[model samples]
Target: MRDTDLSVELCGIRLRTPFVLAAGVLGTTAALLERVARRGAGAVTAKSCSVRPRRGHPNPTVLPWEGGLINAVGLANPGAAAMVGILADARRRLAPLGVPLIASVFAEEAGGFGEVVRILEEAEPDLYEVNISCPNVAEELGMPFAADPVQAARATAAVRAATRRPVIVKLSPNVADICAVGRAVVDAGADALAAINTLGPGMLIDIRARTPVLANRMGGLSGPAVRPVAVRCVYELSRAVPVPIIGMGGVTTGEDAVEMIMAGATAVGVGSAFYQRGMGALEAMAAEMRAFMQEQGFGCVSEMRGLAHGA
Candidate 1:
């Protein structure tokens, strides 16, 4: 509110603020997407859909710990075909608000990435977030494309060929060198990047029940826990590639978002915070960011970006 500019351009898409609603957090429906947009999200990303429908893992798929939440939602979605209608509806609802809709997609194979993108093109989303790094579905989908530089590039290329829309390849933190995959995807024609989808296929147990907390037994860790890893990944990727980066993981506050921007993120992705707090989290984070910017004398998001990388 101090006239400090939060607007940032991501691959030609101008966001009113630096905070984007990360995919999979209340992104399954048009109403939910609209709600986040109304709540102050600069942009909204729909849940990751595939070429076909998925039942996803059963209940108890998400559990909260002292640090954060572990979830194995298994990318549950209505599939690409059905999602076209959902996305079109979301776009109509979002357009009036001047908020961009970013469609997220994932596939079990390289070519499948393109196939899904083509089908979803009917919805005309402003951007495509090619999710090649979802950690919760490794068993069903096999190793994530983000694990291998070659495979990451291949998936990125597939999505690139299918859409003229800017593509942001989501990366995983479970790899040896995240920068390797980052450079590969950029070389393969990705217009931008999003890093550290979630950390670990970590597990939790019910002490009394003597069973795993989540039915899937393993889930990706998110919330306050993964911010460090996310920041590091974004920092490395920002330096490794020339495109814009959407940094996310456990960003729960405006200070956290600012830390991410200083870490070299063009935009900050907000996910688990919505769960930890509520819809108000976005507004709170935005206020906090503005307060920090005003206090620091930073005029815009671009000025704070990569300050950690020093000249």
Candidate 2:
């Protein structure tokens, strides 16, 4: 962490590193987040949980594609009520490392977001991360909640009203105008933003089995394939919204993380990369980012953030 000058402050929470383990990866338990933090992540977002315990989609929920991987885990998790103990354990486990536990919540309905927030409030999460748009849910309307400014604002407002904890709204990239959605959520009281959730409700065919590879038929696309689009979203939203952005998509390496930061991400989310390179990926990214900074003669992350805006 020393070589990079990677420290950053999101909303009011401070992080020793700018590398965060994105939601829905290895985020179910406090132990997992603790392990990642000890390995070198600045923070970790627990898997997205709902008001009710969900089974999520069936088998073949995750598939490795050519460019990246597709997943429809259905946001499976113990309900918020059940997560209270888990969050408490996570809060305790991360306290020593000084890593913040960002509890990610997803609800089928707008009000449900607030309900889950209230449930986890007692657990004392360092931050509340609301997942307004997950492409895997079949029940969603024409677009995910992050696509509609109205829906995004409503959800953010619900979570904001429910907790005093800093709130981060993770937006989706499937929308035509993600900046509008980001701005709406910010106006609704989101303290920070995580740009570009997985890109598509895409699917793959099991030619050998003569059926769809994923049981859900479609899942969000993530990994190297989405980096370009993710960077674009971060770049645009960085200029449009005033809050900090946690950029993600295909950040598999430290250089990739640097690209995201230059595109306007205050921090970077390492998701599918977690699977591709394993836990060592975080450390690798930090070292690589530091080397890049040294070569470019930049003193810190802030100096490079949004550097692409003018380009």
Candidate 3:
């Protein structure tokens, strides 16, 4: 066995590995969350839920492109109140595995964010990831809250006030200045941040039928295609803010996670990778990270954080 340690601490929460099962990937149930935890995920985030249930987009919601995947799943969920049972069960399942359950919440308005948080507090999640960045819901919600510093802060502050859990604000890459948003959320009471929620609200056309592949027409691009952007956002945020960051985008391999860490991410989020590499990807990634660390003569994962920032 390699002597390298993959454990990481994010906002006082100790993670056995830096690999977090990013929100939205089979995150709707306690069974799914527990499955990922048993498979080696250090932490798992539940799907983003709102005050009320969402129908979400219809068929062809996700598609794989040459680079990665493009998705417009909309923010469909069972809603905060409905998810309490699932989240509570998930927390129970994950607790035995020594994994933390992160509940992600969103809303149509700033105050709605707190209302959702309050409803879901019964689950007692280890952390709350305020998803102010989902691009798929822009059409319904009117320009994602993450696109504006004021809106992002408002949403974050609402969540902070509703729960004592660590609030990790999820930011969008479609913004003009992610660092500004990062700073805003931090000042408003974010305990940590998750960057680059997806690149563009891009679209794909099915030339044969002359129609869009996704039912929603446009969706956020993710996977390897957006990894570079994710790294840049985390790098800038680490410099601009004084809180931990969860960097995610196109991260599929152990080396990818290591790169994210070097870019200043305290933890790396893995979502599309599960679809691309299966649930086993987490264990594989952790192994890959350990091998890389050993080969590079590093003793722990923290040693790789922000190495890219050095001259």
Candidate 4:
């Protein structure tokens, strides 16, 4: 493990290692984020912030099922203005370690996306992950914005115009055509893409209380169950667009990260795994990835990207 070459340079940013802390996973506080970075994340993504603050949904917002978790966090966070300060503090704290900070932002409309992007631009994160697909939001917006090509493009374009930072559009697996949305956003100006946000507005009922497990009634499903679907989406996106893909869904182990890379992801995002195994999962995944690559006679992650595209 000590001699494994697990490092990668993604979209011009050099990552000491390939494992990144996905959004909403220990990204709230600057101290916690620095700790995760010190624990061995190549980079960290902050939770989705918007132009306005949100209290999000009530208690019982997350449920751990047999193989995964369903959550309706509803993008709870301080507004973009407040988050910028946090991002600055994190960047300053992690500077000595040279870890990159990624800021993720979301909004209900294209204009709001632009506004949030502008507000966050002041924080100067290493990159920006434009989240257009949160299944836990209000019903009035209908499906996730990433589900529609027109909406995806509009939002992506707004953010692109607002910031010079590399923008990665996060897509939803619940869409009818994930590739279509990917193409739309990339065409609009996304520098990269993160495939397969959670799946399903799934539910779990509490028979005793005669109510749903989540206060929101339904939530997006994630974990091992969605890894296969994520692989398929990343594989398709690799062929559909020329941008580097950040693959996520159920990456809990190094083997899972390997599978994602072989499926065409330049980098792997581990979110649900945090809930399943805590921060230790990041190191475990990296170790597993190194072992698999070494055993397979591969020297670097670039060599394995898209290796499973046609297979």
Worst 10 residues of 1 by lDDT: 1-10
Write candidate 2's Cα lDDT for 1-311 as tens digits. Answer: 33558888888778888998899999988899899999889899999998889888899898887899999888889898888989899989999999999999988878889999999999999998889878988554345788789988999999999998899999999888898899899999999999778888888988999988898888999999999999999999999999999999999988898899989999888889987998888988888888988888877888898888776
Q: Estimate the TM-score of every prediction.
A: 0.98, 0.97, 0.98, 0.96
Q: Pick by lDDT: which candidate is best?
A: 1
Model 4 residue 211 distance off true place after TM-score fit, in angstroms: 1.6
Would you list the C-alpha lDDT of every candidate in the order shown?
0.93, 0.89, 0.92, 0.87
**Candidate 4: Cα lDDT at 29:** 83
Error of 4 at 233 (Å): 0.7
Model 2 TM-score, all chains together: 0.97
Task: Kindly list the per-residue Cα lDDT of model 4 for residues 156-187, writing each as its tens digit.
Answer: 99999998889999999987888899999999
lDDT of 3 at 228: 89
Give the runs in model 2 whose Cα sits over 4 Å from its true position. 1-3, 140-143
Model 4 vs. true fold: TM: 0.96
Give candidate 3 regions above 4 Å deviation.
none
lDDT by residue (tens digit), candidate 3, 103-135: 999999998999999999988999999999889
Residue 234 shift from truth in candidate 1, angstroms: 0.9
User: Could you tell me how far off, in angstroms, the CA of residue 259 lies in candidate 3 after the best superposition?
Assistant: 0.6
